[model samples]
Target: MDSGDILASLGVNGAAAAAHALSLPAEAYGNDAQLEVLWAMKAYNHAEVYFNLISSVEPTFLKLTKSDDMIYSKFREDFPDMDIKTLDPELLKSADAKEKWRPFCNQFEGIVEDFNYGTLLRLDCQKDYTEENTIFATRIQFFAIEIARNREGYNDVVHSARAKAKQQQDQC
Candidate 1:
């Protein structure tokens, strides 16, 4: 009688298909921009897993990590008029940050088009993922900050957590 029963009656794998299908926003049902963001988020999520794993094992990766924008400096040597300062900061938020960010985003328009900007996602803060301390960030901003965080050692706390977890499991 309800949506679940209707789905079942229609012979859809109600539980399995419903789990993924109904979870999307009505706007995201077919919007290419939303779909691309979702797909990019999936790849970014996988990259985060590997980023955490590799940085945990070798802190040097954390020591050496750099945002995509950071490579701009090297490019400047060949193109003298190319100012690397035009790149966005590693962490971005607030209206002013967005205003200052237009040029950088323009350069990557093919890749970062949606700039829709209002959406929020629950995520692990580099130090702690507590709801109280958590901050909401836009999708593109997340890419910038995370790249900087991993490089700047903001994720070093994860190593300690992993160590503590291993010790507990070993004792068990």
Candidate 2:
């Protein structure tokens, strides 16, 4: 796919918007086609790893970053009303959420790698990654939502459901 298609598929409207989402210069995008491909690859790899992780084991036992406790506490404090098990992309992408998330994201600058970099976030905890079910979010935002999902038992439910489905398939 061309860059425009790729950007659209990733939920980015344009190079300018994609750059803004990633907190990078707009010029940094169109000038390097290879860079965009690399970014797509990285996103796909991350999605694959996370899908496998949640499917294979209990996500609550998984630690996303070294500062899991601190991050989880802050996430809960900042988003007390967030229904992590049924996370809505519209709510997360809203102006209010963005305004609140900036500071929360900035606080983990050094603790998380590429903390502000754009990443693909699954909108629903019970579903695997899919174009319609994904949205672009900062890495820290992904961590916060996912950490909440894991801790709240949504991901464990996903794991159990997938396992049961696989067992049924084997029996069939």
Candidate 3:
């Protein structure tokens, strides 16, 4: 199966798991930590699906370019166990994955710049409070992954050109 199919399957499984976890009795719902874990899993699953759908496409590309029947079929098959009734049709329609992803990329760029600011502040601070700086640190960590992924696209282009040049050199 393609990456999209794999991601869709994972998303479906994640939704099912989250629903099952949520169905537990109030007392059985456990603590905030458990809830956080469930939410995190859901977030990861959604992100994987979104990224798989959009990552390779050009900027400003629209998911609507794909057939609606196909998109709906994938969504239904992947999330069969979930309560999709609450899903926003408008949001889904507007979620042209490629175009929407630009904001995420921009956020990632901003976070990296913010990290540079943090580094400057850290140098001026008398005592280390790295552990206490969870918010900014977490932002940095997450954005770093985004930045790396973004860089990978550019690297692929450059690498392809280098390979082509090397091939020509070898021919000479």
Error of 3 at 165 (Å): 16
* Candidate ordering by lDDT (highest first): 2, 1, 3
Give the residue spans of candidate 2 off by over 4 A.
1-31, 169-172
Task: Candidate 1: count the clashes.
Answer: 0
What local distance difference test score does each model get? 0.46, 0.80, 0.37
Candidate 2, pairs of clashing residues: none
Better of 1 and 3 by lDDT: 1
Residue-wise C-alpha lDDT for candidate 2, range 1-172, written one tens digit per residue: 6544665675635555555544555565575775666577567768788889888888879998998888899999988888877677766778987888889999998888888877788877778789888888888888888988888887897789879999999999
lDDT of 2 at 143: 89
Error of model 2, residue 100, in angstroms? 0.8
Q: Could you say which candidate leads in TM-score?
A: 2
Error (Å) of candidate 2 at residue 16 is 27
Q: Give per-residue CA lDDT, model 3, range 53-157, as digits (tens).
A: 333443123233223333334333433442321222332224573254344334434323332212101111112223332122123322332223232242233
**Runs with alpha carbons beyond 4 Å of true place in candidate 3:** 1-17, 20-30, 64-172
Report how far off residue 138 is in candidate 1 (Å): 2.7
RMSD (Cα, Å) of candidate 1?
Answer: 9.3
Better of 2 and 3 by lDDT: 2
- Candidate 1 lDDT over residue span 47-140, tens digit each: 4564566435643254222335552332233233422222222334557755755555455444543333433322443443344433444444
